[model samples]
Target: MAVRPPQQDGDEPDTLEFGIAALSPHLSKSDLTFPATTDEVVRELGDPAIPYDANGNTVRLSEALGAVRATQFDTQRELLDALHPVLEEYRESGGGILSQLRALLPF
Candidate 1:
């Protein structure tokens, strides 16, 4: 099943959304404490799929966090910074001929 984002009370998205900024909403929850490990973040957020590529294909939060260098993040800013490069790299890995071929396939 595709992952669905939570509905916001307002139409405007949070301004903290800059890099893996798609994740800002998930990370901003009061229930989720900071100084979290990647695993902790994944667990808290329920491993939702994040849009990763230029083509808008998504990978699970856990899957994308796999490539992040920092295992622990003291704050949301630290986590977002660590994830920025990883997400950027993932974005570059898509929208190729193979992806196009996959779109044509029945599965």
Candidate 2:
């Protein structure tokens, strides 16, 4: 379950804010807060332990740039290969929630 931070009224800017920034143009003034630090932000959201290095130093999300590194593996290809048979099975079963979800995928 994703836990959102408590909302504050007109506490800070959009870019620097967390929950509000994520919800963006859709968020109301009542749904905002002034998070003093990244720790505060993380605590409010009930996130799991922040990623860290082998040295036990806390790793900031911005600093962990390599986390998004692309690999030789093709994610789309892997997903399609794994899901095709399950989708086929759902179709043969006269369709259900899995079939509906499969239909919604851009693939």
Candidate 3:
């Protein structure tokens, strides 16, 4: 993912990367079908890599889904909302200062 920070004066933001890892079988949120069961999503995604921090620590998509209580996602936004906290915790667990600092910045 290419994360772009908010720009000064409403200008376009600049994209920054910290040695990010690519998701295997790479698919974006838009590519997913909504109201998907956890098993359904996992089977389609096949445990793609999900980077948690700047250092490239990762958790598979299936593992992330397992960390959550929701068994079905009704929308792409719902999936992201449910996973955000889990992802954040994973990031901060190994993140130290950098990830914490990154959390304060705009996306």
Best prediction by lDDT: 1
Which pairs in model 2 have colliding backbones?
Answer: 8-32
For residue 103, model 3's alpha carbon misses the true position, in angstroms, by 23
- What's the ranking of the predictions by lDDT, best on top? 1, 3, 2
Each prediction's TM-score versus the true structure: 0.70, 0.21, 0.62
Model 1 lDDT per residue over 1-107, tens place: 12334557777333322237667767776367889998899989999877764345666788778888789999888887887787776667663476667879999
Best by TM-score: 1
If candidate 3 were superposed on the true structure by all CA atoms, what would the RMSD be?
8.7
lDDT of 2: 0.32
Give the TM-score (vs. native) of candidate 2: 0.21
Off by over 4 Å in 3: 1-25, 29-31, 95-107
**Cα deviation in Å at residue 50, candidate 2?**
34
Residue 104 alpha-carbon offset, candidate 2, angstroms:
23
Model 3, residue pairs in steric clash: none
Model 1 deviation from the true structure expressed as Cα RMSD, one decimal place: 6.8
Candidate 1 residue runs with Cα over 4 Å from true position: 1-19, 95-101
Residue 31 of candidate 3: its Cα lDDT?
58
